[model samples]
Target chain A: MTNEKNKKVVIVDYAMGNIFSVKLACQKVGICAIVSNDKKEISNASALILPGVGAFADAMATLEKLDLVRTIKEFIASGRPFLGICLGMQLLMSESEEFGLHKGLDIIKGRVVKFPAVNDKVPQVGWNQITKPSYSNINWEETLLKGLSEKDFMYFVHSFYVLPNNNNIVVSETNYAGLNYCSSLREKNIYACQFHPEKSGESGLLIYRNFYNLINK
Target chain B: MKNIRIIPRLDIKGPNLVKGIHLEGLRVLGSPEDFAEHYYNAGADELIYMDVVASLYGRNGLMDIIEKTAKKIFIPLTVGGGLRTLEDIKNVLRAGADKVSLNTIAIKNPNIILEASRRFGSSTIVVSIEAIKQNDGKYMAFIENARESTGVEVFSWAKKVEELGAGEILLTSVNNEGTGSGYDIELTRKVSELVSIPVIANGGAGELEDVVNVIKQGKADAVSLASMVHYDYVKKSMVNGSLLKNQAEGNIDFLKFGKISEKIETSGIEEIKFYLKDKGINCRK
Candidate 1:
């Protein structure tokens, strides 16, 4: 039986990230999300969404200052559905090379790295297609990208990308300026992507809908 | 190849969305929220909201409009004008803007570009350059609604901003802005070639071919349009009367009485994308 206890989706707000847009995206999909850094509120959430857009070191510093680093790690460890977008996804890595070398939450045993010097721009801004990974047997229908078509367009604005230690976690990959990289990943209860699904239009909304459905189920 | 983004730029005055020629002689279109929502639904790759008078008046008031639009529109929103400090950029981003464009202050004090890019991430900081082709064929950067000249050359400024860690550059050709003639190909090409960061070519998209030429010849990573798409959206809204709302803002008289001339050749976002695709130019589909 679904009750109020089972419906809470907490968007961890540690004074960074586009919290409003994430909250509004949830609202559009009929999931009321509370943007908070409160330990109790976040720990008690049925589902947690970690959304951010900024430097990795600064984001990690702020999360540490707000005392949310441990709270978030614990929340993910609890096996409740966890979602991370953009920088939030990168934070799941063990470390990132942005600005200077810095450690991450190490939730997924991955490393965040910058796009190698290429003919294209640094931050792969605007809409780019995400294709299902060929190496992984993971089905899109069983993850956050459940209803998205193969090679569907999603909005992206980032300078760095994540490299998971294990390929099994990666759900989708995107090609940018000849650099085919991991775009999204699904690992047990953890869902993360380098693109901002909230700003990805109809296909993006579907991602939120899928996450919402996952929470209730 | 990365898809070329087709961005619809809306210039705002007070409460209404306005359009002007060469960034002057403002004419109110309608509510920006209406246009933003229309473009978002119509499949715009991205949307740029420029507060034209915000810098001149010494205040930035797009927070409310951004908040209201961000509630419904599920696309990246770039807010520009009068963002003089990191606090202003932070507040706007908090209000739901994915990126903040700095023009006047970026030229006045270039250090802010470095500071903002570092603090907010380079991708979140966009440096918009308003360029006017001078007699010597050199593009000179302008500020304060193109009323004041910064006396700096556009090419150098583009490189400097990139060196300062700016993720992208919004290069608007004052010579071609709102004229519906075409983009300044030479100017766009020079800037795009000078910087590694993505350059969004703004102003002078009179037709679909103009859009294609800018990307193919000019090498612009994206195109920012105002008159071409704004007029088309306004014209269509006139027929359906769907974009009009009761709340009054800016100059609503255009929506009330003004008529879009037949000579105002325009194209929708989808049509532009289709045309770009037909020409073998990859755009958002």
Candidate 2:
């Protein structure tokens, strides 16, 4: 195993994500991470975190304008541990119907769609539970959710969720207003969650710690 | 579908954490940092820091406190009071607030809500509506710590804000605030029913049942409590002199004189969550 001091984490900044909170969370877990938009720095890091907040169309435009779309996709293709958060998670899908069909990174074969009109609010903003998907036998100990027990509550705030074409990639699912949707997925070295682990308190920190441990391994 | 959010609201005056009845008679509590950390450790779903006097000063002074709090706490933080323009909203969000609540400015220039929501995501813009029941049994929106009335009907303004792209609404009842009477279920339900976004019911929480009633009856997605939790934490731990030292900011007379208000009921975040869960209204544990 490589020395812990030698590992570096890069938080991709396309000027859209909540870079500060994610950086602070990394600092809390003893990981020296840098917030960068530089392709060279991002490609060289041991791990990458794509964090975002905003509309799908605008985010895609910003990512394309910064020329980070290719850099991010290549970084993942190189088999590095990558994590996507909130809107960052949505960008991994094929496209989003948020502001009228916008193309995504297409790393994961899926579509991002809005929550159906139900008795609940449009943006399901609150703490909700993430349970193991019935379709997969994946254990929490095997993924980025290392120490979290079943039904552990994580913070979520969004109007849309991902519908991955492959159920095997799904690690957890959450129900909101009678719609059971994929909340997080693990595809090879790629990990993404619709929830904001940086804002979920102690349980959230465990996620960063797990990612850090994975990098050191 | 989703668990109700239990938020601890801290009203700031100068540098001290203060509370007022009906949003008046400002009384000083201990350090905001101490109280905020305590709530976070005890499992507060979120936090709201309102600069109660910011409108009067014409500037929001929560940048320092927000920066300090954001570094340590890991929950969603919302800052309100005297945010006038897009620049003000950007500065506060950059200072580490997850969301900025607008009241006075949103009423004066409703377009700011649309503009800010466009610049930053809609989730970052929260419009706070301070309402008081009128003589005709209708609610009127007020601004400036509930001191000035906008003369706009509450229900209509709530709908307009949603259309303007605000992600959430923080609805406070001037009639019930700090009185420990309970939340204004009627006002909350009416506004929440009018908008599709999440509505956080603030003010008038005297007991655990009050928190329950707001979510169950008012149909509120969240509830913001100050006196109930603040008084409880102060009475149990703060009076010991271990947590609070007079920093010469705001009024510490209440702390020194051991004259913490007697009328306000007290409950911890843990206790509130337990009660809410027992009543079939789920909360983050």
Tens digits of per-residue lDDT, candidate 2, B122-228, equal 88889999999998998999998888888899999999999999999999999999888889999999888889999999989888888888898999999999998
Task: Say which candidate scores most in TM-score.
Answer: 2
Q: Provide the lDDT at A190 for model 2.
A: 97
Please state the error at residue B206 of candidate 2 in Å: 0.9
Docking class of 1: medium
**lDDT by residue for model 2 over A1-217, one digit each (tens)?**
5456659899988877477889888988888899899989998889999998889999999989999999999999999999999999999999999979999999999999999888678898989999898877998899999999888889998999999999999999998978789999999999999999999999999999999889888
Best by DockQ: 2
lDDT of 2 at B25: 88
lDDT by residue for model 1 over B1-285, one digit each (tens)?
A: 488998999988877788988898888888889899999989998899998888555343578898898888999899997778889998888888888899999999999999888777788889999999999887899988788998999898899999998989999999888887889999999999888889999988888888889999999999998888998887777786765664365556667775654445888888888888999998778
Candidate 2 residue-wise lDDT at A133: 89
Second chain only: TM-score per model? 0.95, 0.96
Give each prediction's root-mean-square deviation over alpha carbons: 2.3, 1.9
Please give each candidate's TM-score. 0.94, 0.96
